[model samples]
Target: MSESRLHLHLHFHFLSLLFLSCVSPSYFSTTNPDDNSYVACGPHQAQVLTEFMNEFDSSHCNLSDPYNGVWCDNSTGAVTMLQLDDCLTGTLNPNSRLFMLHHLRYLDLSHNNFISSSLPSKFGSLNRSYPKRAHW
Candidate 1:
């Protein structure tokens, strides 16, 4: 291969690796159950999550599956990360209990069937201390 082509390929490969690293669920995970210092998710937060789960059809969801991740803050026990991709069906209601999770820093609800649901105004009320990333 030409030198320029080889260099371009290497750059593309590096960028792909970087993107994969950034998107890996384990990179931001804090929910390791075997750790002695692992903090349990707070009752209120857990209840809210349960209510949110109930609002949708979750036949695909494995509540005990670590890949359907939920990470709570070590000190406060507040949910900080949630990843429920492909696990839910049906529209996300406007008054979803999901909006009540004010402590979430990372939330990935991707690949769900929320096409019919409108964006809730309560999205503006969520914790915004972290930078937002909206793909569409």
Candidate 2:
């Protein structure tokens, strides 16, 4: 083969190997080799619901607050639910409102530490698609 042709072939072979390495299972697999604490759940279960609940409990000591956290499957979006009770009672940070507004449904913050105020007028704008009957 000509020198240029040989170099081109070698370049293509290297490119193919690089692509295969990037797409291989060893690179994309969900199994963590370091710490096996990772739970590989489906799209619905990918949300950080349990972690948010634990954080809420740890941060504010309220066990019954029903605000859940959701992580979008295809995107890096994470939607957190901060109920009025949690917000007013100082269990959840009010600054979390920015991240909690998108992609949510059921927010139950009843009988915890709220001061009994009316719901926010813009509460309906929140995207809370997950129903209570759904499992995630």
Candidate 2, which ten residues in sequence have the lowest lDDT sum?
Answer: 13-22
Which residue ranges in model 1 land beyond 4 Å of their true spot? 1-37, 63-67, 115-117, 125-136
Model 2 clash pairs? 104-127, 104-128, 105-128
lDDT of each: 0.52, 0.30
Per-residue lDDT for 2 in model 1? 45
* Model 2 lDDT, residue 67, Cα: 19
TM-score of 2: 0.30
TM-score per prediction, in order, is: 0.64, 0.30
On residues 37-64, what C-alpha lDDT tens digit does candidate 2 reach at each position?
2323233322333323322322333223
Give the distance in Å from residue 105's predicted Cα in candidate 2 to where it truly belongs. 3.5
Global Cα lDDT for candidate 1: 0.52
Task: Write model 1 residue lDDT over 36-110, tens digit each, in one string.
Answer: 355566667766666666565565555344323567787787877665555455555577777777877766665
What shift in Å separates residue 94 of candidate 2 from its native position after superposition? 9.5
